[model samples]
Target: MTVLGHASFFAGRPVVEVPASGPLPAVDGPVAWRIDYPDWDNRTDETPSPGFRDRFDRFVDQTGESVQALVVGAWGYAAFNPAPIDQLCAAAPRLPNLTALFLGDIVSEECEISWMRVGDVSRLLVAYPRLESLRVRGGENFRFSPVRHGRLSRLEVESGGLRPEFVRAVLDSELPALTDLELWLGDPTYGGDTTVDDLAPLLAGQRFPALRRLGLCNAQIADDLAEALAAAPVVRRLETLDLSLGTLTDRGALALAGGQPLTHLTMLDLSHHYVTDEVVATVQATLAGVAVNLSDPQTPYIEGDEVYRYTVVSE
Candidate 1:
């Protein structure tokens, strides 16, 4: 086990703890991995610390048993070229067990269009051919064309705003057999713009055939829109749901609570909305058969700046 912290080009850099192999305790298997470091917002021409790269290479080379899943983030904020990242992946011997690649804030921040669109979604997708799980944020003018892959199981897109065309592209292609979908839209500064309309349209039809988990966050959406989106017959197996924002309202709640039996849902979150005590009570009563999480009756929605952020699950 090894953890590496890196600074791109910012001051007041804090020291990061790198993991060492030993009795560090057991973690879930299946190519499970994660990396955190400086993001694209702080890029410079300076080369990364050699020690940092060396340690990473060692992890891929000497880590016990092939890593089955990888969750990478914070770092790798340089412009998207695919070559460098591909080289890094190639340096490690073939990881036969590698199945999933979890990326945080890289697709949107690092590969940002303003920086330079060296590559599109196609490039990165090909670079990490074994990726099964992908999570990204802060993308601007980034267009992705979904490619076909057989091992992918989950895809999470967390952004201030997501384009409809790109969203459609995601559903069109079969990558690693995506089963879980999570999307976060809405930019506070530009509250409700063209982007809001572009958000859910990507999921208009049977885009995700195997999707089972859906999470929507911080978007200019309404209950009706959410209800209509959730009524997809193909997504009948959805097990976990998180709809937090003003977009999810009473009508959307009623639509979901009344329609479709989400039999597998174990974790359901409905927080930071305009839900009243009566509405919450209605949901609680309707969803009594299943475990649902609604905001406390006394908890009122705060105005100006009260956004619900942060929800992480590990298994």
Candidate 2:
């Protein structure tokens, strides 16, 4: 369940990583293109590695016209690499058919979640008006501006620590067509400084009128968040609600179980939690019809009087 593995599929198409520098193979149906920075150590020549723009240009020349989805992985040294957001935005015209894009798809082996540096893709959203989905990984030095895209149905972000600014930008954004939204609000120690107030707009249910799936997972403040969502207006409209991968305890679970009825939801994912069996049973009974996932229950470290609970992905 860790987010360490590379994506096998995207935008309803199979993933195919484009060669670092070779003729792209033909005779394939629609597939998601994964453009990666060539591993520096693997290169035989002493020549410098190609920047993301060069690889992207090559991708554009080969199958840009036919490609419907694109994933950018390992732009350079994962610790300091900032994605070429401007260049990608400028070259949007070459890939008119692109309906989806994922940035910072590097795995943990290259760089841990908290160490990656990624930039904003709001410009790309503006450039690709037809894009239906967008996904991003990493959090360090990540930037995003509020944007509106008519066709965007899904927007997802994964980070070891998500900042408040990103949350504010997304909540302030007007995504009339967005149906799915997931943001991993990682631990504050890693740089996730987002507070529940920053998520006020989303909980208010004024933005993203079409949103049906809402996931505010991987937060250190899961209890407080559960308290907020216990009475949030957005919960009533959502078909899927994910509060997993966090340090949720019985306090939070009891609040949810005693709060508003979640009968309207079709799926409720509370996996990777610190709740006990009693609370788990209560939640299951409450949302009996929903596909509730209570897997990977965690135990807090109890030393003397203090207790410590951690989210599944804190790195």
Candidate 3:
């Protein structure tokens, strides 16, 4: 499903947006502190209600070492800096216990997915050595370096068009504890430059042996991906395979149905697709034991001799 609101839960903790210049809530258990200017849609750089930096400072002042999870929301409407890479990296020492983080959690109202510009997120990994889960949203000006992270287990990047270099960097890195890897390979019209060939290392199971959930979703070349993934070495060991929010047709579904036996899987999400009802039955019959999400079957847009298929989250 499309992300319409703020994250309800993140990193196994319930999300609570804490205000600036306010008393800290009585945190009995772990909670993900989501920092952002209130009514941020109407907010501007001139507003007296604190900017992201001020809010972050307040949060750190109130609860520094105890903070376990954090989500960085809209930085500013017209403020000096947009991305919080510098502030976040600079304040890493103040947030020692952070294990889960979500950067650029701004919704479509604040900024479109393709309009966001994120810098080298590998710095976050380096800054938070004990981080277990990290999620980033955006694609434009996004970057990554092939850095080994030992304790990182879950990594999710929600993008309109993810860069091939970034994808390659992720696949090349060494994450001995990585279990969940979900990437949204969005529309090419919005700079989705990644190809199926770039995913070879992951499909071959060359890295991240502990990876059990693999989601190469929101792709334009889903049929090609399905063809390659049919016999990929990685699928055998995966418990969850999410090919959702893509342009997967009956042809791709048939390939998956006729390919390897995926009876071992616990969940298979193929939602928001264009597969026919007959093929849908075939897929359901093929992987009956698995919890397959075949919702929102789309009918391709037709104009004369041309047919157009689209992914779910492309803006």
Worst 10 residues of 3 by lDDT: 40-49
lDDT of 1 by residue, 129-246 (tens): 6666554443434456867766667666555445566666666676536667776644433222324345443444345556667666655564644576556554455677777643
Error of 3 at 251 (Å): 1.1
**Residue range 87-114, candidate 2, lDDT tens digits:** 7888888889989999878887876777
Best by lDDT: 3
Ranking by lDDT: 3, 2, 1
User: Poorest 10 consecutive residues of model 1 by lDDT?
Assistant: 1-10
Provide the clash count, candidate 1.
16
What's the C-alpha lDDT at position 63 in model 2?
78
Question: By lDDT, is 1 or 2 better?
Answer: 2
Q: Candidate 2 — what's its lDDT?
A: 0.84
Candidate 3 residue-wise lDDT, 118-188, digit = tens = 77888899999999999998756788898888999999998888888989998888899999999999888
